[model samples]
Every structure is written in C-alpha cells, then in structure tokens.
Target: MKKILNPCFLAGIIAVFSLTACRDDKMEETTPDQVQTANAKPEQPNPSEKSCSYVDSNWSWSAVLINTLPTTTDTNFMNSQMVNIAKMWGKSTPTLLFVNDPVSPGSTYNAASYKTGYRIYYGYAIYNDAKAKGGDIVNAMILAHEYGHQLQYAYNLPTVKENTGRSIDLEADGFAGYYLRRPNGYNKTDFSQIAAAYEFAQSIGDYQTTNPGHHGTPAQRRSAVRLGFLIGQYDVTAKDFDTTFFAYYNGVLDGSLKMVDNTIRPEIKAYLDQYVDELKKIQSGEISAEEFKNLK
Candidate 1:
C-alpha cells in the first residue's frame, strides 16, 4: 500500500538530512576579480572538435578531455545533461571535464564540481561500475548529483547557518532527486529506479561528524534524496523548488518543527528503516569509521 508521510514527520526527516554538509577540497573558489576580469572573447567549440571545448570564457568554464573514456560519447552525454540542467535555472552551460584520476587516489569513485567546470575524473571507471550495478540510470543519477552542486554554485543557496557543509550536500542531493523525477529531466517515473540509485548515495555516506566536510550518515543521505524526489511530484520551477526545500530544511534545523510518524511506501520505508539506528549512532558520534565502513 502507498504510504503517506505526515507533514511534520517529513519536515523532521528533511531537517536531519539538511543539517549535514560537505567540503569539496578540489573546488577552487573563484574571486570577484577573477570573474570580472575574465576575457570577453567568445571561444566557441569547433564543429570538428570531439573532445572538451569552451562553453563560456567569462566564467572561465571550459570543457576538458580525459584519456579514460572510450570516445567523446560519454562526455557528450554529460554535456547534454548539463545543458538540460542549465536551462532549468535559465543559466548558461557550465564546462565539462573528463579526467583520468582525481588528486586523491581512490576518490575517482566520485565526481566533483568546480566553478570552472564539472569534473568526472575516472569517468569510465565510475560509469562502468554504476552501469554494472544498477544500469545506465545510475550514471544519470551521479551526473545529476554533481550538477546539483553546480546549481548551488549558481544560486548561492542553502543560506547556511551552521559550521558544516551538510546543508549544501543534502540540498544538492535533493536537487538531483528533483531533476530525476521531472519529465524533462531523467524522466524516471519508476520509483524503483530511484530506490536503486539511492543505494549509491547511501554507500558514499560518511561518519565524520566533527569533520566540516561530513556529507551525512547513510540514513540521512537516503532520506534527503527521497525527500527531493517527493518534492518533485509537485509542479514547480527549479527556483521555486529551492525556495521550498530550504524553508523546510531550515525549519527543522531551528527546532521550529518536530517529527511525526506516517505510513511510508513499504519498499522505501523498509530500506530506510534498516539504517535508522545506524544513522542515530552516526549523528551522535557513536559509530566509528570502521563500523560505518562495514555497514551493509
């Protein structure tokens, strides 16, 4: 049976998920002077260019090439996705980069967003892994999540009130979820696909409570994505979605709201309930990195 979430309970879930944030060590903060001083010359991609090319020099956003992918096909796919995302915000396309490795080894399992461009370091490796595990939809989710970061950068959102980066991370996750459910976005009408992609998000959750870069516990991350997916059910623009999400996110963070239990879809509720205790422990700093790593 379909479950209905109580408004207050839903608010609390969003609150917990939104409270955490992450720091992208790889993302360089561009200064006002840098943005202002950027060259005005338009550097368009050559029609024959197969690899990365310039999108906008004013923002210093450019597409870059990496040696890991079979062809420009993957990169092209990402560019198209970015274009779709950009259109939602009424912004120009950001640059794309396909890189072989991240500065931090083994981190290629993830993607990072930069003011200059979005980097899919280890693109082929991550794509192949996600494809094997959950099909191409997983790949779409990853791109959507990273693009969520770009949205944050574009909107200067979250209006943070805490010392951590969790708010930004959660909001980005929410944005990705929102996009995936949109008709013009991933058009993933099946909730099962979202559930499958969410596993990837859960896998990346960390137990670094004191770390300013902490993304959130597995449960919190899972809930955040789910909340975003639910919010997308409504007809709203990207800006309106952001505004509504933050209102709920901040309401919970400030204690102006409380959690209440309501029926949840059996499949999703069962999946999330399994990690409730673990998430509680994570938020309380009772879970260690070893334990977090071993969580299934």
Candidate 2:
C-alpha cells in the first residue's frame, strides 16, 4: 500500500503494470507502517467479515499473472497446501480470506497479508487465473509468499535494503523457494518443481524498479527463489538463514564477491557454484518459461 503519487496522472501508463496496494501496490502489498494513509479508502463491507474485501473504490487496477509452474498430479494443492506452508515456518496459521468481490471480481486481482491484522487474503480471480495456468502449484506459491511476510513481522527479520519494496518481496520469494524444496515442506526433490515455483514468482515481478512498491524484475525474482531452494538443502536457524542469505544475495545482485572470495565458505560456494551458470542464464533472459519447466 505504498502511496501512488498521482493515480489519475499515472492511470494511463499503468495499464501494463499492476501496482497492487501492498505486494505489487494496487489493492495490496505494503507493510503496516507503509500503508497509504493519504490515499486510504474506507473498508468495504462484504458477505463475511472474515472474507477478503476489495475497498480501493477510487482506484481501479489489474495485472495479468502468467504462471509457468510445472504440472503436478495433485492439482488441488491450493485447497490443502496453505496450512502446511505455515507449518514449515513454525508459525500459527493466520486467518485465510478468499476475496470474491461480487461487485468487482476483476478488481480483486491481488493477494496480500496483514501483519497486524493476523490474516492473509487471496483474490479469487487471481487464484482462478493461477489455477488455470498450472493448477494449484501457482496459488500455493502465492500463499507461501504472503506467509513469508508473516515470518518477517513475527521475527522482525532483517531484509535487503532498497528504496522500494523489492528487497522484502524478493526475500519473500526466496522463502517460497525454500518451502518448495523442503522435505518437510513441499517435499519437492526435483529441481524442476523448484524451478516451477520460481516461474510462479516471476509472474508477480515488475519492471518498475524505481516505483516505491516494485517487487523485482522477473529474472531477479526467479534468481531469488533459486537461491532459496539452494539454501533449503540444509536446515539452519533463522538467524543463520538470514546471515547466509545476505552473504550470497548481495553478491548475486551486485557481483561484489568473486569466485575466490574468503567470505563464502568453501562448501557453500562449491555447492552454489554448480548453479551459477543457470542463474546467469535466467538473469540474462536466456531462459524462457517453457525452458524453466523442462530444465533438468
């Protein structure tokens, strides 16, 4: 919910972009402290007090979510996988609200988390779009991502610094990657599914790097998820996880660390090195969604 400077002025330019209030900045995404107080709209009444509601009356926005997750035999993951996501992080389940705004179903094309309100909301339209793309895996990734913000609020986790929300969003994407691969989590041993989840992450990415709510470019988001899956190979305390994440992530973004750096441990660099080439391919846009799914 970071402030959109001029809705009327940018309305035309925003057709291809989302800007979901909290996550992407349209009707969702900002942390509580970052809510748009000036542009705030009164909460809209809905069928159930607990169901997700779209209240941004004055702002009409939308984004197409193109999911590239590999197919799964269990296509009903969206119905049962959310609770397991919370379990993976050892956090209490938050209230789950499905937003099927009768008045404007298309307007509910966003997903978000309320840290203080202790809930997560998924827009039914967005969920349906995801379901159509790759069944429930896409939606499961979304739920895991919103849950990542919950972990952030609970532990007051440190995030990579950026002027926009990209850092937190990318970190959330990373956490989703970890969940996708964890044996006790999604239990996906195959990198194809791990890659599948990242493709889902890519759908939410935007090119608005300077926008206050920019998540990340598609490639960067995929890289973040890939890094998280790599980390999932071992179990580490949250603090160590944070430490380890930044150690490599900073290098991934800025290329500050070299192959022979002392900061990265031998075992880690060795393990991570195996994927460096593919990661570079992603960042350079050499890989496509179809390619991502079929990769060995």
Candidate 3:
C-alpha cells in the first residue's frame, strides 16, 4: 500500500481480498439498483444471494479475468490514479476494493462507491468490459467518476437539484470529465482522446429516465462530460466545480449556455464560448460520434 499521511484516509486497497475492516460479501448485497448515484452501491452480505464461478471462457469480459490479485505494476498504476484523483479533489484516498471472487463471483458487472465503507469497488469483469469497449483510459474515467461520488458525499454538492437519478449520476460524470484533463489526474491535454473515451459513459447510458436509477441518456452523459472537460481548464476547488457544473447544467444539456453576459468569470467564459454550439450538437446527437472525436 502506498503510504498516505491521513490515518482516517488510509484506505487499504488490499482489504477487499486480505483485510477484515470491509466485508466484500455484504458490500455486494448493497449494490445500488439500476438507479442511484455513486458508480455502483453495495448491499449487506446475504449468504443466500446468488453466486457464480469463473474460469477461462469464450465470453469476452472473462478474457482478461485471471481472478487473482493484480500484479505489482497494475496495483501501482491504480495507486497513482487514486493518488492523483484524491489530490485533484482535495480528498484522501478511499479504500480500493477488487470485487472478483476467484472461487465464487458475487458481483462481476458493477462498480460503486459507498459512504458506508469509505472506498470504491471496481469489479474485475466491468474493468475488462470497459477495456474491451473503450480502452484503458475509460477505466480511468470510471475510477475518476466513482471518486467523484466520494466528493459529493463529502461535500453535499451539486447546488442544482433535480431530485432525480440523473442529477447525481450526471454530475459524477462531469466530475470524471474534469479529472480526465486535470494535470494531477489523467492530464489528457488532447481533446480528441478525451472525446473518444466517451464510449464507456455512453455505453452505460440507459433510456429509463423516469427510473429512480436512470443515470442519463447517452447523449446527455456525453455532453455532461464534455462540459466538465472544458471546466477542467480552470483551477478550482471542489465547491467551485459544483457551482459551475450546476450553473450550466441546463445550458449544456440544451446547448443554451452562451457567453453574452455576466455572472460567469470572463476568462472561463471566453475559454468555453467556442464550444457552446458543439455542446448542443453533442447532447442532441446532432453531431455523430465520429465528428465529436474529430474535434480539435
């Protein structure tokens, strides 16, 4: 484990498999329904819950699943990402849980963050699926997004409240976007790479907007992340991120955010003015994915 100064925040990523503080079985029981914020929430461990086993498979996601502890390189890579993201949001690293049961896979297709456990869970299956769908950076995006929920739980955020599933999930999506570009995070200086990583966000999108767990449509998610990436250009605190994101959430979704007037800091507005129309196109699907990726 990479040493951290904060005892309260010294979440042992090794705990999921080897430690005893957090219970992997119980966490899986709390898995958030299709709706709800925080990547994937967990449940109390119920022994009666269904379970399965894993081995080499013809299936795609299992292709990468050796279902063993990650190698030193893999652990270091995740530690760095967690450190960067924690630094970016001004929070401590939460415990990291690897939710793969080499014996019996309890939760294989989800990821989540929990106020209860003070950590994030990344299922091996979902990680591989993300790689198969959108490459490794997408997992970075996922990790960042889950940590974003940690921010919310810590901050009581998103000043704009819709009281719906989308509000929470979409804002987390925005946070992921911000992390992807921040110097301390992924440092994605190129818009093309950032834009191309949209597949994972879009892939998780659902049509059940009224569902308590509806995250957001694919188009809305794409636009939310795009707006967050644009906001990453500024050096802002966690509170500042929430303010700006909520301030423009509507405009980003409908493409109505304009630079014509006051309220927004002039420098930030100037930076974002160029993307207003394109934001509209993305959210509305007026622009194809190819076109979005081609953006400079």
Judged by lDDT, which candidate is best?
A: 3
lDDT order of candidates, best first? 3, 2, 1
> Model 3, which residues run further than 4 Å from truth?
1-69, 102-106, 258-263
- Backbone clashes in candidate 2 total 18
Q: For candidate 3, write residues 1-296 as lDDT tens digits.
A: 00011111111122223422323233332223132223232332333322221211111111112223355665566667878889877777787755554322323455667766577766665655556677768878888887887887788866666645677778888888898888887998777887546766876677765655667777888788888888899888877787777767776567676343465677787787777778878877889988888766
TM-score rank, highest first? Answer: 3, 2, 1
* Local accuracy of candidate 1 as per-residue lDDT tens digits, 84-191: 876765667665544322221121233556655443232334555566677766667777777776666666666554566677777777777777887878877655
**Candidate 3 residue 165 C-alpha distance from true site, Å:** 1.4
Candidate 2 lDDT tens digits, 216-269: 777788878877778788765555555566766654454443453455556766
Q: Best candidate, TM-score-wise?
A: 3
The TM-score values for the models, in the order shown, are: 0.60, 0.71, 0.77
Once fitted onto the true fold, the runs of candidate 1 whose alpha carbons sit more than 4 angstroms away are: 1-27, 30-68, 71-73, 102-107, 117-122, 250-296
The whole-model lDDT of each prediction reads: 0.51, 0.59, 0.63
Over all chains combined, what TM-score does candidate 2 have? Answer: 0.71
